[model samples]
Target: EDQVTQSPEALRLQEGESSSLNCSYTVSGLRGLFWYRQDPGKGPEFLFTLYSAGEEKEKERLKATLTKKESFLHITAPKPEDSATYLCAVRGSYNTDKLIFGTGTRLQVFP
Candidate 1:
């Protein structure tokens, strides 16, 4: 079985603030890890794909890093426009394409 857990269910930040969100996970057979950002009512937008330990990816104000048992989403200089729910998902080697998703971390940035 594979599982993902995100900390700080919600976060509030003033404009220009930077913070990091944690994602802890466990999987039977390691495969791949993914990160996404979703708006209030929209589907998750792809952020990154981590296939090996020590792998890292970034986009704009966000950076994602992966390890054997966990991942991290680092947000830098966040603005109100950056507010959204960040999600993490992982696929195990045994699974087809189905991914186990995390509940998500809701981030609110205020100006």
Candidate 2:
């Protein structure tokens, strides 16, 4: 079976606090790793895609980096507006491009 896991199911941070979220997986033929931010009751917004190990991407207050077995999302001095659930997914095969998603990390930034 495909496997995806995220650590620290939930996190609470004061405004301007920085932290990192982790996503780990064990899958065969990893095609890509994707990161997304999902607000309450809303669909996930795509953040970055890491196609291979050693690849990294950044935007605004967020940076995503990938390794052979896991990935990390780094938040740099996030604001209250950054509070959301962060999702990690991996596409394992080329047949259909299906994504197996982790449970997601819940982040709350307080003002």
Candidate 3:
């Protein structure tokens, strides 16, 4: 059974603070891992796609890295505007359009 799990259901950070979110998965023949950000009432905004282990992508204060069994979203000096729900999803080689998603980690960056 393929599944994705995200840790620390929620996180709260002060402005300028940095942290990382974790996403772990178990699947047969991994294909790709994706990251997304979602606000309170909107759909998830695509962030990154990692195809293999040791792959990484970055945008502004966020950096995403992938390993054989897990992925991490690293935030550097986040601001209040960075507060949102971070989501992680993965696609297995068995399915082209199917994606297993985690429950997400709600992040709050306060000033």
Candidate 4:
């Protein structure tokens, strides 16, 4: 079975605080790793895609990296407006348009 799991369902951070969130997975032949950020009552916004090990992507204060078995999303110097839910999904060789998603990590940045 293909699956994705994210740690620390919710995180509280002070403005300018930096931290990293974990995204673990178990899948059959990973085609891609996707990262998304979702705000309250809205759809997820695409963040990054990792296709292979050692590959990394970044935007603003966010960085994503992938490995053979897992991926990570790192947040740097977070601000209050950055508070949102971060979701991870995996595309497997056996599934088509069926992205296996994690529960998501909710981040709360306090200014």
Candidate 5:
């Protein structure tokens, strides 16, 4: 079965701390994998989309990368404003219209 799993269900970090969030998946064929940042009481905000292994995307303090079976979201010197739940979703070739999403890693950055 195709599935996505994220580790460290929650993360607490001091301002300017750096860390990496993991997203692993097992699918028949990968079409695209996505990253999103969602704040409380709001919809997810798109971050990146990686289509194949070795692909990467970056925006400000966030960098996302993809491998053959997993993806990673790296936070660099995060600020309090970066606190949010980081979500990972995938689109498999078997079901192009559907997306499988992980439970997400809730990140809290404190000063």
Candidate 6:
């Protein structure tokens, strides 16, 4: 059973508070790990794609790293605009193009 789960369903942080979000996954023959940031009522914006363990990708205030069984999204000095739903997806070798998504962790950065 391939699955993805995100922790801390919702997070509220002050403007500069930094934190890490977790994405735990269980998949057979892992293909890729994807991170996306989504705003309310819109599609997810692509963040990173991790292909193997020890892979790390970054953009602006967010950094994502991957391992065999889990992935982490670390936010550094987040801002109000950085607030959104962070999603994790895993692609299996048997499943192409489609990514199985976690429910997502909603983050709110209050100024």
lDDT of 3 by residue, 1-111 (tens): 889999879999999989999999998878889999999999999999999899999999999999999999999999999999999999965857799999999999999
lDDT (Cα, tens digit) per residue for candidate 6, span 5-108: 99989999999999999999998888899999999999999889999899899898999998888999999999999989999999955857778899999999
Which numbered prediction scores highest in TM-score against the true structure? 3
List per-prediction Cα lDDT, in the order shown: 0.91, 0.93, 0.95, 0.94, 0.93, 0.93
User: After best superposition, candidate 4 residue 58: deviation in angstroms?
Assistant: 0.7
Between which residue pairs do clashes occur in model 4?
none
lDDT agreement of model 4 with the native: 0.94
Candidate 2 lDDT tens digits, 10-86:
99999888999999988887888999999999999999999889999999999999998999999999999999999
**Which structure among the candidates has the greatest lDDT?**
3
Clashes per candidate (backbone, < 3 Å): 0, 0, 0, 0, 0, 0
TM-score each candidate: 0.95, 0.95, 0.97, 0.96, 0.96, 0.95
Task: Report the lDDT of model 4 for residue 7.
Answer: 90
TM-score, predicted candidate 1 vs. hidden true structure: 0.95
C-alpha displacement of 46 in model 2, angstroms?
A: 0.8
lDDT value, residue 33 of candidate 1: 90
Candidate 1 lDDT, 1-111, residue by residue in tens: 678999889999999989999998898776889898999989899989998889999889999998888999999999898899999999965848889999999999999
Q: Which stretches of candidate 1 lie over 4 Å from their true place?
A: 93-95
Supply the TM-score for candidate 2: 0.95
Residue 77's lDDT in candidate 2? 96
Candidate 5 all-Cα RMSD: 0.9
User: What is the alpha-carbon lDDT for the whole of candidate 5?
Assistant: 0.93
Candidate 1 clashing pairs, residues 3+ apart or interchain: none
